[model samples]
Target: MISVEGVAIDTRHWIGGRRVASDRTFADISPIDESFLGDIAAGTAAEVDAAVAAAREAFPAWAALSAPERGAILRRVADGIDERREDLARVETRDNGSLLRSHRRGVMPRVAMNFRFFADYAEKLAHPDMEIRGHRERVTYDPAGVTAIITPWNAPLMLATWRIGPALAAGNTVVLKPPEWAPLTASLLADIAHEAGLPAGVFNVVQGIGAEAGAALSKHPGINRLSFTGSVPTAGVIAAAAAPTIVPLSFELGGKSPLLVFDDCDLDLAVDLAVEQFDNAGQVCLGAFRILVQESIAAEFQARVVEKARGLVQGDPRDEKTDVSALVSRAHLDRVSGFVDRALADGARAILGGAAPEKGLYYPPTILADAKPGSEILTEEVFGPVLTFQTFADEDEGVRMANDTRFGLAATLVTGSPEKAERVSARLNAGTVWVNCFFVRDLGAPFGGNGKSGIGREGGTYSFDFYCDVKNTVFSPNGWKESSHG
Candidate 1:
């Protein structure tokens, strides 16, 4: 049995609800210490084909069940997750280098919540009825056949379930292609679903690199819908591959989200929110890493932020007191450090950390200020514990600076005036605008991106729209009379 942190897992492809081993395997290494975790099954086109075939064969039976029946099974899955929350948390922290406390307290719990929320939502789903030209029109949703889901490495279990919950709740069978960097929890999830009484082939996981299992799943003609959460370049590749079959796609890509700090706002709150970008070692796609402060309070805000960055406890993720941890891998660390290095070379100032740690995959909490406009660091996503600081002269400039990016995933506004919050939020180009807050997610609200950040939204009914086929039937007012057959 493959194990991490005492949590024994079956590191193989789960096809037709059974453990299916692959011909090849890859090393699963820990970023915390570069320790070898285990060998995970490396999937290719063959595994993807098998999983997709399984999903297609199981679709009719799964979709034939009543929505409430499907939801009941999802609730059981949620219960299973809750029962193993601690074990799962430990395994995830060991596998991904995320803080143990965060996994135990937030990420694992949210994974369970995702299942429960979607389970309830699927049961309570109601479509609007309309009368058009004296005809009664009723809208209904039917489960799209097989769904192909590709998830990222940063928060593997949580992000996968964010899509998986809704897909299963909507009565569609799924074939998940989890990121190779953190594929352990996904294998564990397959076991949980099987224990929760999900039927064979209803949910499957194929583990491997993006070019093999991921690409095969994306281009599979058998898939009815595809949902991907990752980078923009990967999204483009997946989109291009799926274009031939014209499969419906839902994408939640990367972001360079902004947090605007105004002169009239609470300084402490602003600083606290700024420091929050480093959460998960700044691997968060929705993180407001680009901080645009008003010129009046720029000096004070920058100083306090730098001071707090210096004081953050960085070491073992297993430690409860540790506030930051390692990047997912050395390549990611190099990528992040490369962005900062280029920024510094281009005349940007590093107020805090600018160097990679002497050992381990830890890149210090870095802040780069005064990067020239249109620079790569500001335009592209570093996806690290790095922040870019700039000052805006006025509200117009603040809004403009925040909106001046190809990414519009999310934005944050800090102000004492409710009117300013309302007015500025309206003008902001982001899909979600947080007022005096960050990373507050409500399942009912739509979540995704605006431009290249993403293609569609997730959560509540928005998810159903992608996982199910919405159709309308029109009834003639005088089409039939009672007891006409008799």
Candidate 2:
């Protein structure tokens, strides 16, 4: 419905320093009502080349800036995004099907906070120790030249900004390839960065399928580092593509995380936390997908969760009181529906929701009971608002079941006893574990999984490290150091 600079922008690509339009552009339909949003231009190899070339050209100067200068610019960028928070939130809601209330209130603010966090940590990040063991020696940090940041669709702008913002603060020129499914806000983010006085080519966004544009960005020799946030299978492709170049890579992959509910925890409190953990239909990587209920209170816990889950009203995200919204697209809904069907055939009982609303792209919030560990519902990252439950015989068994999956992003533990909470928290293999709570994330904490769930850490100081390379600068006081070479 809206056009910018005469180009029809859907969730399309912005390569190099220009917006691209293609005849082969694809439609962007809002999942809320199955209405056609607009069309996005597919990016080509040439565009990728141009983006990388521009990044390459901009790298030296961007990298060479003093740490304070970079930090100041990053602060300005954060302020700019904060100024346009409401507009950014609307674009995100249109692009990702999240609630406007949550987008404007929760998502956009967190993104701005991330930028400010990076700005605050920028100077501290570059501080290197002076070594005087036997001679005057010191070390410094250096930018990794051009970085390729590939983001996902779930939390489009927020997730990508976590990578792009800090990467820029760390002084790396970036060629961003946002998910084709959710690309609009990334383009908007690029516009904001430009408007905030970021040099052209210092940051760029290209919209295209991961198979085409994403692969090209990863494989390009000019890019010294690649930061990716998506599923594991896709991460494999990116890893393979970047292999020849052997660039440093940061990957935050899939998660089939667990949440353990103990008998000591208030049943009502546990139920509320479990439902909220899946916030926007459980599509997030850190979603507590598997619920491992303690043996003593399994029945009571399941009953409370089912009651809460049953009350959810699934419809368009725009509705003021809609607790849940549609999946990203029909294709995604079909995939989720197929998973539910397979789970049922495998003998999993659907207690809450198992089908999509017939009228629109609305997929109901679902909860499955007694699903086996090997079943599709339990094993794979279903990525829908589906909760799979299993009863545990004891505390040890619950911890074992929680760590069974290959993914380990986060886990939520509900228990009243302090000692028990500590024991279980220690046993959880996930990067983040919440005791008596769920979805407790702070901007300063380091968050990422230990197992197949991820490769690198992100958040506050950790995010800055991913985008930079530490250089050892040894200062020899005696004129010049002797070389071992003949």
Candidate 3:
């Protein structure tokens, strides 16, 4: 067990605005290697109840805070996060095995910005057009009682805030479940929120695995809604787990996002952005994992991409000079390696990296070419720095290829023509289609995908519709179904 200030920080659980524990604990390791990171207490169903109960107890007060008032507190919280920027960045990098430089210069800054973004955005949230309908007066939005945020470890800090920011901004109390793989960052973030003047239980976190704590959170009687970001299988489990309660569940599930580069696109720009898409070891849910390049320039673009990927310096995550680092764990590495083997068997040729480096859980930034459609690698989400590319003949073919996946969370297109870009973007079948950029999120823009990519929109000013319950009112031009008997 690790000790922080001699408080036996090894065994810890976040409950009721503080870190508490029962009797269970597990060791955390730096994703760089098997070195000890720390030990966190594993919360069980009982502990999950504690967090849900806290969020429920705090809901009325949190829901009553004016948008601007909540915004102000969140702004303070964002400021506090910036104050401890380096510390938080270090913890994230150490715990998750992502590039330290990126974590500090990229992830941490984005996290802080997300907080600030939502704080400012919440104040601007206005109701939809409340117009009269046949036998009905109008419609409106209201905060759901308690919200649960189930975040993955790949980018825990950023996503936790992404899920919690808007919910809290609109006055819904939150209980978050940080990925068991990287619980400390969320624990620390919760601590910062507490210090930022958030009321006790307004924003609570509990530590445990998906089966125990997560199932309990999804099935909790008091939690009004569930916002989850992870793989598709887990989403299915959440759906089944929430079945008995029939509570609303929001999912941001697996994505095999594609980047289609037409012949007109500047090759350099496309390659650079594609690298960024798969950076930090390509563990992001929204990373542009597939590249569908026009055949006219596929050969040259492929070579350039392979050159750039090969240049990625793989080493200790703590080194400031490193471009990429290790995968999150040995099990994850094994899974990715297994996928690489499958891809190889199916005739996908690897141009850069395919195996986990002998040293750490590092998978070299790999580029695969000639990958057949519906190949396991192409069809499934490979959350690694590995990128798969296939060539197409025409604009219509490119768009069709981009939209050929069951997953459609996001897509990117690089073309010079205003007309062509719009036409392709329109038919790409993705929730977010970017013309010249990738992975950019406007906090107020609704962002949920079609198909198996999950349901309900998040971000923008519209997500409250998913997080809130509606009551239809009709009584001599104004009445209510939820109101007391007339």
Candidate 4:
């Protein structure tokens, strides 16, 4: 076990603002070197019962607080996260095998920002006030009771807070089911919440495999709302579990997104964007690994991308200069490698890496050209550092190729012309389209997918809409017309 900021990270469930043990525990093995990290408590339906009860009991008082009051607590939470950013970043890197530099610079900061942004947003939240046919109307958002949040392994703290921040800011008590692979930071979050003076039972974390803790949390009748971020198949399971209870669900699922490069684009920027897919070993759902380059410039772009991929440093995640690191686990590494192997057999040509390292969980930044059209490598979410090259002749062909996927979470466009960027962005079948950029995000934008990628948006007002029950009240313009009937 590792200690951060003089506190030994607890692996037990964080329920009612304290650590609670379970009957069984599972070992958390680090992907960096396969070392044993800690023993995580295996939570089950019984633990879920205790957690839901805690949240249910805490809901009334939490929701009763004024928006600013809750916002103040969240701001403190954000501050606490910032104060321990370095410690938390190290823990996250050790647990998940994501680069230390990334966690310190981007992931950890974004986790804090998720809370701060929502905190201020809650204070300024406003619904439309209107008058129609001599009737005055105003809307209010009432907090949905006990929220069940299930977060994925990739960028665990950031994603968890992305959902948790809004849930708590909207004044709903939360019980979060963090991915078993990287559950350490969540326990630390429970500590930070307590230190930040967040009331007991306000935020809870249950750490275990999805089948046990996750299924129980989603299937709980007491849960008023659920938000999950993970694979499409896991989402299907959660949807099934929640359906029986009729619980309101918000899902942010998988993506096999595309990055389109037009002939009239900045070549340097397009090449850099293509290289960015190698970030986090390409675990990003919106990484845009499928590059649809304009046929005229396709050869040049592929050559540049290959050179960049080859130069990437693959080693320990703790090293600051390491550009790539291990996949989350041996099994996941195999899964990613299997997809590449099959693609090569189906006529795809590897430009950089086509195989995994023999010793470690490391899979090099792999680029493939001429992937078969209907193959799994082109159609499925590999969720690794694997890029596929496809060429399009013109604008119409590029847009068509970009939209030719079951997933529509996000798309990237690289072009020099303003008119083309605007026109093409509108036509792309994605919830978010990036013009000359990638992974640039705003907390207030609507952030979810269109098709199998996800259901419902969860940023700014969209987040509150899902976490709260929007209610409209109508009355006569002048004090209900003095109760004319009476």
Candidate 5:
């Protein structure tokens, strides 16, 4: 047990539906003030094996439950999350430096909804049967057995629930490895699932660094599938580890997504969206690192974006007024600052917020102008509260610039004309496209990326498909008449 601001938190691994102690423990430091929040269990390969073995042991019984029965349990989990929304939100904020207000009003609600959506969706699944000539074919979906869910630090609980909800709904036992930077919420979630009557070994969480816990889960032979969300390099490591067994893998990786601002769009709205590049201190993978503006309104748009970004309050995440909070850690803050420094060295001009705060892991909302097309800041994922500005003379040029990056996770286009929206949206290579707005999400819609951004899709039916395996059976009216060649 560890105390966080006077609250005692049990930071143990939830395996086999019980809190399991580990030989090693790691500190959970708050990015807001570098305060010691708690100690998390430092899981290892041994823990991974134990968790996977438990999941395998529980698979048959858990999967034997009817879809509606499983969905009822998930619905209960969603309700439980909603009941503890405030507590979960505060813990998430303290653990990951997310703004308190956003976590309460935005993140927690989405986390609950992820469970509810998957609960409802589970009952709606159909494995249709077909009949042709004198033969009949039937399709069925089965759980993919033991699965490992490796989530990122940003929006820890929300992202974990995004995968867990569907994986559970599909009747698959789960072993989750929450990011070491933010593991409190995931630990709490395990307790909630237990209280909601989730069976032992049906869901488990092992908290530790990526190399030990994550790699162990990825390479574990008992795990039939691995779902991950993180950087490209980490995804590659996971791919390599799981390749030996040919285990199915699903990844939602990094992105240098673009936000296109057209001349015909509302300037104020465009500026608002551009300013949102710093949301979650711009730690989000879907954030627009590159803002493409039309030449005609480029000057005015850039000024507006700079002004809005400059006005964003940078302070304690617990304060509702603070729009920009600290990065996940000191090292991450330094990495983000280094991106700006390198861009400056490469001839990019810092229009606003070029330096880090005097104390804490805070980097103010930064903007770089005149960054070359292929420069580091422009092409690579800075994953900070920084946006690079570039101007295009025409629609074709704007679309070209948006698709220039190797990442194609997401893109946003601001235009009033539906025709232009359709045309531009169609041309963008990203997995998700938003017209006239940014960060608007629907749980039922598919989400993920193309190219290096990630592989496979997530959300709604896509998630169910990934977590479950499909089988087809064929029957002939004439039992032994299928030997025409013989």
Candidate 6:
């Protein structure tokens, strides 16, 4: 166990505004140096049941509060997160092997911002009322009872807050299941929520592996809605489990997104965007895996991309200078490495990195040249610092190759021509399209995918709609007059 302020920190399930211990615990290790961070409670089916029951009990009261009242509590939660920004960021860095620089400047701030945005947005939420043919019609948005929020390990706290903030703002009670690999930050979030004056049972955290706790939460009958962000295979299981209950589910799954580089594009900016495949060690779901360069300048773009990728510094995540860090775990590192090996065996040439380091769970940033369109390396989501290069003859072919993947979470197109950007953006099969930039997110815009990437949207007004149930009511006045038609 880890200690804080001379006291051992207990890692347990947070239920009903209190910490609840379990029969067993699992150790959390940092991938950066293989240091044992702490232990998290091994929650089970029974624990999931208890948490859901508590949320069900708290639903009526929480949903009864005014929208502004809920918004105030949510705003306080955001402030609390901001106040402990350093501690939260450090914990996340240690837990997930994300670079400290990313945690500080990117992930942590977004975590707080998600809460604040939802807080302010909740007040502006409204259900319109109109008179149709002299009859009164009203629309109402109600909480979707208990919500099950399952988050991935890559960005645990930030992703959890993405669903939790909107769900709470929409007056829904949440039962959050943080990835067992990085449960510390989420456990702390439970405390933060309570400290922010959120009512008991409104938000709960249960920690365990996906098979036990996650399955239990998904299969629970009391859950009215499910929001999951993870791999496609796991999402399939969750959807199957939730099917028996006929609950509404929102999924944000894997992606094999593509980045298109036109001959007219700025080579420097295109190179930088291509290097984003190495960002977060390429664990990002929206990271571009396939680089489709126009045939006219494919060779030049490939050379620049390989050089830039090789220049990225890889070392300890805690070091401020390190541009790339270790993968989340040794197993994941091996998985990513295996993909690279398979690609080389299939005649794909490595332009840069192609092997893991001798010591830690670090796979060097890799770039594969001559990768075929249907090759496993190009189609599958390696979720590592691996980039595959492919060429397209024309605009039509470039767009076609970009949309070839089964997953379509996001796509990026680099072009100097405004006409080409507008034309290509409309044809891309993705939830979000970046014309010249990559991973530029706006909190107010919809953020989800099509097909296997995800089922529904989860940002701005879309999040509000997903977390709540809309009901329409119509009434006829005692002396209502019908509209006269010719």
Say which candidate scores most in TM-score: 1
| lDDT (tens digit, per residue) of candidate 5 on 1-486 | 765544456899999988998999998899989988877899999999989999999999999999999999999999999998888888889889999999889899999998889878888888677999978899777898998999999989999999999999999999999999999988889988999999999999999999999999999989988999999999999999999989998999999999999999988899998998899999999998799999999999988888778789989888889999989999998899889999999999989988878888988888889887688888889888998889999999999999998999999999978999999999999999999888887888899999999999988788877899987889888857566776
* The 10-residue segment with the lowest total lDDT in model 4: 1-10
Ranking by lDDT: 1, 4, 5, 6, 3, 2
Q: Model 5 — which ten-residue stretch has the worst lDDT?
A: 1-10
lDDT of 1 by residue, 275-338 (tens): 9999999999999999999999999999999998899999999999999999999899889989
Q: Output the lDDT of residue 152, model 6.
A: 96
Candidate 3 structure quality by residue, lDDT tens digits, 205-225: 788888888988888888888
Candidate 3 collision pairs:
353-366, 443-460, 444-460, 445-460, 474-479, 475-478, 475-479
Identify the superior model by TM-score, candidate 3 or candidate 5.
5
lDDT of 3: 0.82
Report the C-alpha lDDT of model 4 over 1-486, residue by residue, as the tens digit.
456334579888999878899999988888899888878899999999999999999999999999999988999999999999998998989888999999988899999999999989988999878989988799988999999999988889999999999999999999999998889999999999999999999898888889999999999999999999999999999999899999999999999999999999999999999999999999998889999999899888899888877889999999999999999988899999999999999999998899888888999889898887878999999999999999999999899999999999999999999999999999999999999999987899999998999999989999999999999999875655555898
lDDT for each residue of candidate 6 in 220-246, tens digit (9 for 90 to 100): 999999999999999999999999999
lDDT (10s digit) by residue, model 2, range 408-438: 8888898889999889899999888888777
Q: In model 1, which runs have C-alpha deviations exceeding 4 angstroms? A: none
Clashes of 4: 0
**Ordering by TM-score:** 1, 4, 5, 6, 2, 3
TM-score of 2: 0.93
- Model 6 quality (TM-score): 0.96
Query: Model 2, stretches more than 4 Å misplaced?
Result: 1-13, 126-132, 135-137, 476-486
